[model samples]
Target: MSIEHDAHASGRPAITEGGPSLPQERRLVTAIPGPRSQEMFARKRSAVPPGIGTTLPVFVTHAGGGVVVDADGNSLIDFGSGIAVTTVGNAAPRVVERVRRQVGDFTHTCFMVTPYESYVEVCEKLNALTPGDHEKRSFLVNSGAEAVENAVKVARHATGRQAVVVFDHGYHGRTLLTMTLTAKNMPYKQGFGPYAPEVYRMPMAYPFRWPGGAENCAAEALAQVTDAIDKQIGAHNVAAIVIEPIQGEGGFIEPARGFLPGLLEYARANGIVFVADEVQTGFARTGHLFACEDEGLVPDIICTAKGIAGGLPLAAVTGRAELLDAVHVGGLGGTYGGNPLACEAALAVLETIEADGLVERARRIGDLMLPRLRALAERFDVVGDVRGRGAMTAIELVVPGSAEPDAAVTGEVARRCHAEGLLVLTAGTYGNVLRFLPPLSISDALVDEGLSILEKAISSV
Candidate 1:
């Protein structure tokens, strides 16, 4: 049989922001919710819990560089990157090999009981790599929420304080404390209340909705934070102020220029431990290694996860040695905190990032995605704001001429894209933002292909 190839096709370019090229041309030969996937879904709806089924309804069978192949055999260009969990790329060769080797040797020894070299190595790397040249220490955990909780523990222990401050629209995790830290209330936090006490909510810099320039927005938010701390919850009682440098679940809400600097100053003056939650923005997803680096702000504590181990469940809190040491022995640790297999994967992930120049690649990908998204925003009145850093980005949807969100239309666009074989994620407190998390290693052609599908979806909207 003769093989067919596209005229525009070239050999898969290394470190491309272009898009993905399969070994062969991509062909969606069946309906998106193909027979196989539908059958599986039927069986899943019967056997699996109600919460397990996908909101998009397409059941993925396999995923690689920049595409997801569903059980129905429909090939889709992946723009969500598994919700930013596969930044280096799905099934990265290095991470896969490391996992295989580690699993063969040992899966878990429970680092808390029997420490391993890989765990210490991963922590050492984190301590050295995280911002702040000053002596630092690291503690590993099983998930982002766990990492955030532990950061709070360390801050409280160091400061002998109880209150923690978080901003609106920031997402932490599903666990009790993190759910409380998270901003949105409906699904994640609804009916799960009587949450951990001493947690306070503050306003984040949302320039698109805020009526002013970047400087003015920052000033307003800073003033609000000051008053909140003074009247509602005094800074003297606060342990830490946790923030997402670029608010992830908060509609990719980027803190106004100088806003982060002002928060740092306030934290310093008030003796508050400033925690930068980079779980969604770390590991070069924001062009720089960490979003905080953009402002040269050295957070007292930093929480990271999601993309650290390629895809494995791993999270960490890296902070000043003195602060971390303040926690009593046995204060921070989990049974699978630094599993050997996950640590091995993490090591490989760091290596792949450096060797592949993914940090720089993320920035280039951002440069490419921004213009296309901005163009869409310009054309569509529903497209309210396009914002983000590096490859981490989003397009907020709104009703024409009003800041009022248009989640219904955003959801419709995503549903349409799924039918057209593109995978994207919806975010924001109101669920009105479409965030993009394409793999850093994706090719330009694939990027354009996905964008074309997106353009078509928006046009239909």
Candidate 2:
């Protein structure tokens, strides 16, 4: 295979403003898992547990903009932004600068012991940026699961209710409580038994798979959800109704229009806190700053992570001030919840997103990728559906002439893309959806190249 370094291939600049200035092109100098990566994989198998799986197993030496450079010098177009953690791009200049300064000043003072300005600043940013204009309080954590766990804790504490309502096809986290809340069984929660209690499941407005056609999905789903809550869990006993605006692991399923609003109204009327899990859809990845903003759905609480800190391990739960304040002082905190370094990186990430116009960049990415994906759907019978918003997009794979999921074809396409030097990811409840989470800093040329690789992979499959 041959590699090109031209920026004009897709009529967009190759240079990234706040990220590493790599050539922004794909280059293959060896097989997918080159010698070095394979060697590292061997060591990883011994050192790491088999449970910790890898996507491509290509050891990355450096990654920036739209490309991840491997140890053997193979550069692959990054369609998955470290699972949507590097929205502003890896090693973003501002993040690097801020992290360096914070590391030099103080690494970890433990926010619970002695809070720092950066931590407070990050909370302030979260309070300001999250969905509602109502006064809100924010709590920081180390991961999405922690944010979610804390959100549930706050909701339960505020409402004095034990039951938590979760929707089908939602991916909360791997924690015991969140695992029970999540709908998927395999990989995330198969052997992990004796799960948390008081977690009730509800139907979601999955348009493609709805019993009625897509047109009637929202109303029907809403009715079913409300009815289920009333009959199964009793709305009065529910503490929170947690949902992902765009179900990430559940195949990037964006509920039909009005679905979220309907749920929010129900939650409000029933005194159930509505929690929007934006772990995968937040921080400008979905055109709007948060996917909830698209529907103008002001959730009672919003959980965020991934792109919040430019790849750092930081997550936050921002919600109405009264609810959050309901928790007793010192009741919500962690040893390394809001490390100074991570807080600094988050502040820089927010600034970079605003100054670099990453939100618009995400929309541009969707504009460039969605049409080509839809075209691929037209060409390939296996392409069941192509849907998403902004940079967070996906194509569902299904058996031809039917909606039955084809996980085999999905795996094959991803494998082929890996061999051809394109980094892609698969998602969905059935593992038949190919999700694309390209960095907001990716160039048009790289986007075109990645899509080309994906097209060939899908065709070959």
> What ranges in model 2 sit over 4 Å off?
1-19
lDDT of 2 by residue, 94-205 (tens): 8998999888888888988877898889989889888778999998999999999999999999999999988888999999999999999999899999999999888889
Q: Which lDDT values do the candidates have, in the order given?
A: 0.85, 0.90
lDDT of 1 by residue, 1-461 (tens): 00012311342435333323343224486887888888888988899898553766777877777787887677888888877888888777788889999899989989888888998898899988888898999988989889998999999999999999999889999899999999898778879889999999998888887766555899998899889898998989999999999988778899899889998999999999999999999998999989899999999999999999988999999999989999888877978888898899999888877877778777777877899999998899999899988888899999999889999999999998888888889989999999998887677667788888999999998
Name the best candidate (by lDDT).
Answer: 2
lDDT of 2: 0.90
Tell me the deviation in Å of residue 427 in model 1: 0.5
Candidate 2 local lDDT, residue 317: 92
Q: How far in Å is the alpha carbon of 121 misplaced in model 2?
A: 0.8
Off by over 4 Å in 1: 1-12, 15-26, 211-215
Superposition error at 228 for model 2 (Å): 1.0
Q: Name the lDDT value of residue 456 in candidate 1.
A: 95
